[model samples]
Target: MMTRVVVIGAGPAGLVAAIRLAEGGARVALLNKGTGGLQLGQGTLDILGYGPDRVERPLDALAGFAEAHPGHPYGVLPADLVARSANYLRDLVGPALLVGDAASNLQLPTAVGAVRPTALASPSMTAGACVDGARFVIVGLRQLKDFYPELVVGNLVRTDLPGGGRLQARAAMLDLPAREGEIDSTGLTYARALDDPAYRKRFAQAVKAVVEPGETVGLPAVLGLDDHNAWSEVAEAIGAPVFEIPLPPPSVPGMRLNRALTARAKAAGVRVVPGSKVTGFRASGGAVDSVQLATAGGDRDFVADAFVLATGGFESGALTADSYHNVHESVFDLPLRRPEGHLVHGDYWGDPQPLFTIGVEVDEQMLVRHPGGDPVYTNLYAAGGILAGATRWQEKSGEGIAVASAVRAADSILAAAATATDQGAAS
Candidate 1:
């Protein structure tokens, strides 16, 4: 019989875990309460951007990073596993769609013109990698209210490029294809408009008119919605290298990535059940036998041989804090490892709050562990934001932790299944 696994949450960690399990010949069911947190991100995978300072080479810094932060998720995972996890995601998303390797971090510009270090980025944003003496023409759509080319340029011109030197930047505003009566639009709306070939051609012409010689074009990340080739097509039409600057929520690039991964999971024979919240579970013999999902009609039970919890941290309500400042894990009520004393500090921008680092403790195999150092449940594993100890926002290691931990959990389950099958054959 096929090994059955139930993965909770639909975020990057859960989705990747489900896909990996299915690929390992397990019947996987991915359950989620709603859309995952991908749409709220930049869609770039950041391994280790900063270790107090900017990290130029993430892979090279992994060992020291892990040693310095022994409580972090990377401490339990091998650096090679982290590298393999990133490669797996790059391959799964197709090399063309998701570019870059673990060799070094790309310095990409954000909407606010701040340079962010990321290990893997889409082709649409890779060209904008910050370099010394680089010239940029930031283009903004008049209809898109979210982006301001002037603001981006103003910040870029003031900020020094990584490694050394400075940047030369200018702002340009162009009207997106005129809407019937709409004056203001969103990133998604602009992306849909750019999906049309004629519209992209006209838009490219408008950009071309403003761009100067030897200048790379930077635009809000709204190149395309349904068309994955829209960015390349626009670049071709303009006869210049164009890159995208990620905006706030409702990010087009994030949506594109989420769509691609979800589709790939389906294609891998993973059963994806969205809007299904796991309310409870049935456990016995030191293992989780099944999980119950809240349904419209009634509570539904999903039986599985193993389970994975990647419901995320405070942002996703997987970890909650009470008025007294005591934190609790929502599902399974697992014990969380917290800081020594105060969770929060007075400085908002100085250092990450201790509260953000609180999460369930997991063993080397990604299985949730008891305070005494034993597995809480033999069949239950945890990954992603829920298995913390790192200040992800401060370190820029959220995506890396998610992918690496998910891969670890899935591989452990697969290895156990293979061993069981071999033993039965021998018997």
Candidate 2:
């Protein structure tokens, strides 16, 4: 008999866990309340970008980072597992699509032209790495209101790279051929238009005319949505190396990543249940039997042999706070580990707030633990932002922790299932 597992949330963690479970021969059901965070995030995988200071070597810094911050998710996650998870995600997303590794952090230019460090990035953004003597022409479409090439160039010219480099950047704006009744276009519209081979050729010509010698072209991340080759095609047409600068929320690169992972999950035989909010769950004898989902008619129960909760933190409503500053986990009402005194203090963006560090505690195996360090449910595990200690945004370890913990949780479930089969045979 196949082991049935239910994974909650559709973020990177949940999707990864579901895919691993299904690939391990388990019947997996992935549930999500709404869309995942990928659409609002950069497609790059950030693994420990900062350890108080900028981290050049992410894998090498893991042990020190874990020691500095006790009870952090990295404290339990082995470095080898973290490295393996990076490879696993790259393989799952396809080597040709996702590039980079955990060995070193790449300083990629953000939408504002400020440097952002990431361990893994798409091929479209790899050429944008801010290195010594790197010259760039930040290009923007006149019709695209989201991107500002002048602003990007202004920032890039003043900013210094993490690895001791200065940037020389210029700005250019070109008018793209407008469709019927179209004056301004969203990233999606521009992405779809670029998918056409003919449109890409014309677009490349326009970009090439504005480019100078020894300057790599930097365009807004609207190259393609459905087509991954759009960036390369444009680069080929322009006859120059080009890279993408990710735009604000509702990101095209992010959408491409989400679509790719979701598609891979489905292809791995995982059943995806979308738009279902998990309101409650049934647990007894320290094991979860089923979870309740809110429906149009009424609440429905989803039964499974095991469960993995990857529901995001405060951002996704998985964790909420009341007027008195009492925070609570939405689904299981699990206990949270919060800092003493005020939950938040100091500047909003300066120092990491204590409140942001509050989350459910999990064992090394990714199982949620009670206040006294006992598993709440033997068959339940937690991953991603929900099981937190370090402030992910502060450290830039969000994707790394999510992927590694999800892999650990799925591996634990598979091992448990195998042990059960062996016990049954022995009996």
Candidate 3:
């Protein structure tokens, strides 16, 4: 009999979980709200801290992990799988999706009108250049998003480049609006403009004009350089090396990757049901029995021997805690670990504390822990950004963490199921 697994959310964490589960021979169904964080589109993967010094290129770190964990879901069965996935993604969008060690040495054009060496996604890139002093200009889209040029500048200043030289930064706005021509002050609205070639051209030109002749411009990560040709063309025309930076969490690129993963999962025979909300779950003796889903078609019950929760942080709207400090597992009322505080720290970059304390706490096997520190459901597993301890932002290990957790969770799930079947047969 095939094991049926239902996964919540379609974000990177969710999609990756679904993919691994399905590949493990389970009938997997991925559910999402259709628009949970996909539009940000800053296409850089941050797998920070690997290799001898706990410092290596992002791609190299991922590649090394894939090589070491060949049987892992994120790991490629063959050595070329890593390159193949990278190449396929590069082909889909544009050539800017750089792979290999060379990326560290690659000179990138910046909005500031200067060029700089690209930084690995893991270790945070310090703002100032070691060589000639450079001016940094941050390009803001007039009506786009939550991106605050001043705030980014402040962060860069705070981080202080490796050298003592001061990194100067200024902000300029691009007058782009959302779908209906209405300007959204949040600035997140300009993300949609990337799909338009004309918009890209105009934005690139505007950025070029603002950059001081000798200075480097640090544009928001959404410059629409989705391909290599476009990246090069924009680089040549702008006459500045462009360094793509990772946007904040719930980022557009993170969302887009999730959507892509969902489509791929569906094509691979995984059932994807978006807009289906799970309201409650039925569990007995610490094991999930079934889940109640609220959909447009009405209430539907899904029974599965195993369940995977990918519903992300407080934003994804999956796990909610009550005033009494009781965390309710959205689907099954599964016991969850509640943090003492809503946030580990008030400041975004204040402390590099683990994010897991705020999320559902799980054991090493990726199984959610109950309030009493007991495994709630042996068959129920959680993975991705939802897992505790992973600070996607400060750690720069978002994608790698998500992929690695998914692989680990899938392995555990399969192993548990096999053990169950063996016990049943003996009985």
Residue 15 in candidate 1, Cα distance off native in Å: 0.9
Ranking by lDDT: 2, 1, 3
Query: How many collisions between residues are there in candidate 2?
Result: 0
lDDT of each: 0.89, 0.90, 0.56
Evaluated at residue 25, the lDDT of candidate 1 is: 98
lDDT score of residue 206 within candidate 2: 94
TM-score of each: 0.98, 0.98, 0.67
Report the C-alpha lDDT of model 3 over 202-290, residue by residue, as the tens digit: 66787788777766655555534222244444556677765444455445444445445556687767898777688778888768888
1 against 3, candidate with superior TM-score: 1
Question: Model 3: residues >4 Å from true position, as ranges?
Answer: 37-135, 141-159, 163-191, 211-215, 225-232, 244-250, 283-286, 338-359, 369-374, 385-400, 416-427
Error of 1 at 61 (Å): 0.8
